[model samples]
Target: MKQPPAVKRLFGLYFHHFPFVMLTTTEAVFLHTSILIFAMFIAYGIYSYLPATIMFSISRASYYLFGESNTLGANTLQY
Candidate 1:
């Protein structure tokens, strides 16, 4: 009668985008779908990674700034 939480969440996410999804059927549609899913995964990964990365960077920088050294903005990408 009831679905599990993970299943519900999964379906919820799928249905949430269902209305906007353009259903397609053409030559090599499976290949195109695979590529699109791969791109979506990459985008989602980067989207999820960004906040944690910035938080860790800021935390490490602040630690170095206050506790370990007086140097701030020492690391830079030289191009």
Candidate 2:
């Protein structure tokens, strides 16, 4: 049976943007899956480590800026 026009157009678009001269179905699936997994790993790393890193930086900055003083209202006005 012949493919529908929409299916033909989709394939045309896919090939038009595809970088490789040829790609088997399995190769395409593996390539896409690897890219997705790599992206997820990067996202997970950022999600796990970014907040703690940001908080640590903020805490250090505040400590340096304010010293050990308990009087924040007065110190804030001085700067």
* Top-scoring candidate (lDDT): 2
Q: Give the 10-residue window scoring lowest on summed lDDT in candidate 2.
A: 70-79
Prediction-by-prediction clash tally: 0, 0
Per-residue CA lDDT of model 2 for 1-79, tens digit only, reads 9999999999899677876468778888887899799999999999999998997777777878987544334356553
Local distance difference test, each candidate: 0.75, 0.80
For candidate 1, write residues 3-30 as lDDT tens digits: 9999999988965755435555563477
Error of 1 at 33 (Å): 0.7
**Among all candidates shown, the one with the greatest TM-score:** 2
**Model 2 CA deviation exceeding 4 Å by range:** 1-18, 69-79
Question: lDDT score, residue 77, model 2?
Answer: 50
The alpha-carbon lDDT assigned to residue 34 of candidate 1 equals 83
lDDT, residue 6, candidate 2 = 100
